[model samples]
Target: MTDPRWGEAFSTAFAQLTALWPDKVAIGAAVSGLCALMETDVALAYICFGALTADMTARVAVCCKRNRPLCRGLKRALPRYVCYLVFIVMAWAAQVAFQRGLHVGLPIVDIMLAYLILTDMASIIGHLHYLGVPVPPVLKWLVFGGREQLKRKAREAAGRERR
Candidate 1:
């Protein structure tokens, strides 16, 4: 049988080890939060890109239906999409390295994720426009500098050249 003194000593050691329980709990929560954020960012990125790809593919099919087969457009677009996916993955890896390896803060990761989301949204908008959605001119201008805006600028430049 264990001695009563030994039991008392074990309880004392256990109590001492658990004295900083709050700090340990805080650290665990923080790590768990960071992991969840990383996972969510990745999932969001994938969803955004997937939607963008589908929209773009549909736009290509519609645009090329008269001139070329849909399969040809898909063949051409597949490599470009693959390249974009690779770029996104590399960027994500760099962000992770900055956070984990270099001990960078969360704001940088947040900024990168925001940038990814905005760009994906913009591309999706552009594709929607190509698919004949009547997206607002102001929104197009805000997101893409507007095709009409570029045409107007070109016309202004031509008028100045005429002078």
Candidate 2:
């Protein structure tokens, strides 16, 4: 049996990892850029970036407590990632309004938004399996299998607890 301390260590490590992942940083960058574009102020934009990061970090903590390893997985994070899309749309609208010109020029924002959304969704699908959340068969084949691993560990942990 794993030591209780191991679980704590794992939790701490995973929490730190989730906070520092590339996807989260990209989301923060989106918020930062949006604030910068809207206010014409770099500092204010960075402040907004920091706020979003902090908020996400808190949410991760909540998710960890509520769902454990499954929360740390991608499925839960994927749904939550929808917020990033909302941020992008809001930013685009603000930019269009501020410029007062119908400039739909392609920007780095589009690429970032697309990559972030796709990657986050992929992770979420994997995590959903860990939680035994039924994903469509089409998606199940696409995601890395996590259901059995999570289920085995969950059952083992429960057995230990009952002993």
Judged by whole-model lDDT over C-alpha atoms, candidate 2 comes out at: 0.53
Compute the lDDT of residue 82 as modeled in candidate 1. Answer: 73
Q: State the lDDT of candidate 2 residue by residue for 1-163, as single tens digits.
A: 8567988899999999987899888977876675556443445334434444444454455567566564463454455446765766665665565346544333333433433434444555554555466889876554333434434554674476445
Write out the backbone clash pairs for model 2: 74-123, 74-124, 75-124
Which candidate number has the best lDDT? 1
Report clash pairs, candidate 1: none
Per-model clash counts, in order, read: 0, 3
Give per-residue CA lDDT, model 1, range 1-163, as digits (tens).
8557988899999998799899988876765565465554545555545755775666575658447677776776567567655655565576677568757543333344445455555766766766677888777666555434444654674476446
Query: Per-residue lDDT for 93 in model 2?
Result: 69
Q: Which stretches of candidate 1 lie over 4 Å from their true place?
A: 1-43, 106-132, 145-163
TM-score of each: 0.47, 0.29
Per-candidate local distance difference test: 0.61, 0.53
